[model samples]
Target: MPIPERFLDELMARTDIVDLVSESVRLTKKGSSYWGCCPFHSEKTPSFHVVPDRQIYKCFGCGKGGGAINFVMELENLSFWDAVSVLAKRAGMTMPESFGGSPDAQKRREKMLELNRRAALAFHRWLYAPEGAHGLDYLRRRGLSPGTLTRFGLGFAPDTWDALIQEMAKQGYDKRDLLDAGLAVSNKDGRIYDRFRNRVIFPIIDVRGGVIGFGGRVMDDSTPKYLNSPDTPVYNKSRNIFALNIAKKSKAGRVILTEGYMDTIALHQAGFDNAVASLGTSLTEEHAQLLSRYFKDAILSYDGDGAGIAAAQRAIPILEKAGLKVRVLRVTGAKDPDEFIKTHGRDAFARLLDKSENQVDYRLAQLQSKFDLTDDAQKVAFLQEAAQLIAARPSAVEREIYGGHAAQMAGITSESMAQEVSRALRHRLRKEKKQQERRDLAPAAQLQPKARSLRYDNIRSARAEEGVLRLLLLDPALLSRMDDLEGQEFSSPLLGRAFDALRGQAQQGLSPNLASLAQIFTGEEMDHLAQVASQPESAANGPRALTDYISIIRGEGLRRSQEQGDDLLLAMQKKYQKSKAYMEEKP
Candidate 1:
């Protein structure tokens, strides 16, 4: 069931759209509104605007506009109910009864959460038991303190087929609950068993302190040394970062992204509290988005091996796309952060973190590794790659700084390097421009509108109808005078559909704001509608302007119909003349 209208209104009122967005985006005050880079897409400049006066935000770059709750839903990847709950909690408001979310869904999620909590506790208990001594000793050998163990809910999954299964079953949870929580797995004969065993358990927690899932590492050398839970209804690994629950509270202004659980734990143990790792998966855009909510800068501390370098290469664009200032932490004389910290004390590691190179320099260094600069062909290849990287930098100052370094590395004059980079930059710009022109010329969208409420055959009526919709979106109260306008009257079906939705809302005495209307439209459609509303120009006289818009829409329809009639009449006249000529020939 949906939330009550009154409660939704109150929720939106309590939530400040600016505060909510500023958590992720860096907003700057401009006139009466706030502007920032669009979090939904990659752009060099700020286009996402928040108009506090209207209680709305719109990204002029990507066309995403909505209110506070809607923004939460989009940014956090939460459902409407979840977004509302987050806001309500922050606002210190109570949900009126079970108006918070669907009763069934809430109940199921609670059950799964309960099961996971119980399982995590059970694993923790087992770590100290006689059978779990091996895992406990392994933690000790890794230099993990007892306090750190408890802090992270570090435990041991017993090395038995039915250990967790029986333990959870004894706690009154059935096999179904275990499976639903991703705590146990079933085999071909329907024999349910533990999914994790003979491994030290690390609970993967969310920012809300919920044990969403678990990560387990083997006590000894094993084929699959590390294992993580599958995506469950309550836990999605793609959007989750291990240790983020604690990391977000750190005084450190930036987050250190590592490759694994042990590395993150080691960093935290060493007083570098702002450390997190992805759960047994490569870095994703969603991960970057999640990270951007906490910190402005991210120092990726992936291992210094080939795979680690490659991973960093892939992560740069994603992190940049998510609008995080990225730097790469390359460890020397050690395999990973854990080993590096262990070899050199916390002070040394901290110094290395402070001295970490930006991703551009890191990649250029990596590219330099591939070439023998003494060889002519290899040096040429090295310089070209360096030029491409240097050309992509938007700042001429940065280009010169990095260009000088590249020139020094290539043993060439800085002036020659500058010319090369500029040439590459111009060539790249031309290529991108041509590509944009091709894309603009092609109607590349695959969504074929099946109804007139989408698009239409007649261009003139579509344009006029779009104007009417644009007008209605800007001023919902204008819908009162639109009683005479049928949705079918608009030439473009999408405009008509939007008009009908607006009229319906006005009839119901509801506010047809972007957030509410978003409930009726898909994200894409909502963005399009919001784009229409974001247009600044409007009429001073409301009713007169609406009447004019309606007249234009209706007149275009009539004009197209008359044009069709003329075309039909011309066809008939030509047929009649041909018949007359045939008759004369017969005579």
Candidate 2:
């Protein structure tokens, strides 16, 4: 069996949704709902609303809506059960004993987490031990200090295969666990070896501070000098950040994003406490959203290599799209932060951070350096690309400022550049709109479907049942009145069952929580219920709204009765006659 509804009911009754969501959002009461700028996306105006009555939330801006459970699931990147456990812990409730999960799955997850923890400890221990002497020598060669090495949890993977595998097994870890953790690999000969060797290690942790995996930098010249943990049960490269666990603790909301672990440690050692890195991967939208929860701004500090500059350029729009105030830190005279910090003292690196340039200025500067303003054709090419990037800005004021900068850089009039920028923005918007339309029209396989819908229904009947259930979810007070309608004729069986379940719980002094309701539905049914529950309604205000909803359901029920006509009347009469005949025959 899945998690029992009764358990969820107790959990919700104990946990308050308003208190849970208010931690991340600056919610203010507006009419019947609490509205705030969505934490999930960038928007100046608030489109995220929390309805106290329904214990549900919706962001019109990003189209993300769900109950409190959904918010935690997305924000923390937790599975549904894990999210439920988090909330239950916060609410001081124990997870139900009847909750079902595959023991094999649990074992796999536990094994991976355990291996990562052990590997991190081993790496940290190696950083200071005699065996780590060579790794220590390598870091010093790279201009790292003892403080920097310890601070970043840098460790060494020995050159010999099976070193870590053997060490772990002696500590009681199994080969299967090591493989699942991405720390070990099996060869054709059926022998397992360490994934990283003769390398300095950097552990990758999730936002919640669990060690998910590691990234390694070779101590000497080698093919693919950097090695990282493959995607596994605990880590996804696109979704994890290297140093976010520590960086999020910084007083500054802004985070300095780098390309590698060394860059992150170097920046941090130089007093840029908010610096973090992607785990040897390109920037991703998941990373952007994750960062947005902690900060409002980002500074992209990529390497100065040709490939690095191109990667930064590619990432600019993605950061902007996520509504972050993005700036690019172009380090010159050195290839990366580690090198820059070494070549010049920490003060020089600090100066560079202080001089970070916005996207428009950075692009314009890069283009100005590339193309001759004296050459008309090159200037035009520069203007076209710069305009496309500048026009994507959400604020017109900022766009105009960048336009003026462009004019100054190209030796043209601000008015001309502004017109060009406007035209480019319109073109970009049209292109995006058309793309979105295509996305909407594409086959379901091409896109992740929004939860699937239940079969077509008589709109009126579905509406009535949906309204009653939604109201019941919002107001515990209305749960008592629902008992009167038990076993009554209902148009939607699922909706009826949901109602009866709530009423049954209410008689036992229980509250129906969103997670419990989730347990009641499966597949398409669950999707349909999520959509229905996420509906925005004004009737979410106080007891009167609940009463009004109950009235609407009753009215709809009566209307449905009238539509059945004389056949319905005949059936009732026949049932009554049969009951009387049965009594006479018994005597």
By lDDT, the best candidate is: 1
Cα displacement (angstroms), candidate 2, residue 399, comes to 2.8
Per-candidate TM-score against the hidden true structure:
0.86, 0.83
Q: Candidate 2: lDDT over CA atoms?
A: 0.73
Misplaced by over 4 Å in model 1 are 1-7, 42-44, 60-69, 79-103, 438-453, 456-477, 560-587
Q: After aligning candidate 1 to the native by TM-score, how far in Å is the CA of 411 from where it should be?
A: 1.2
- Candidate 1 accuracy as lDDT: 0.79
Residue pairs in collision within model 1? 452-493, 453-493, 453-494, 454-493, 454-494
Candidate 1, TM-score vs. the true structure? 0.86
Model 2 lDDT tens row, 1-587: 66766677667767667788877666789886788767677565688777776676777676666676677766666666766777887887876645574334545676788778888888778766787788888788877777877666778887778778888888898788788888999999998889988788888887677889898887667778799999986789988788888998999778899887877887787788999988777888777766766777899998777887888888877776666788888788887887888789788977887799888788778777888878999999888877887897778998999989988888899999999999999998999999999877865433222433443234455566777777666666766444245425456676677677766666677775454654454434444455567675443463454444444555455556566887775654554345344433431
Compare the candidates by TM-score and give the number of the best one.
1
| Alpha-carbon deviation at 147 in model 1, angstroms | 1.9
What overall lDDT goes with each candidate model?
0.79, 0.73
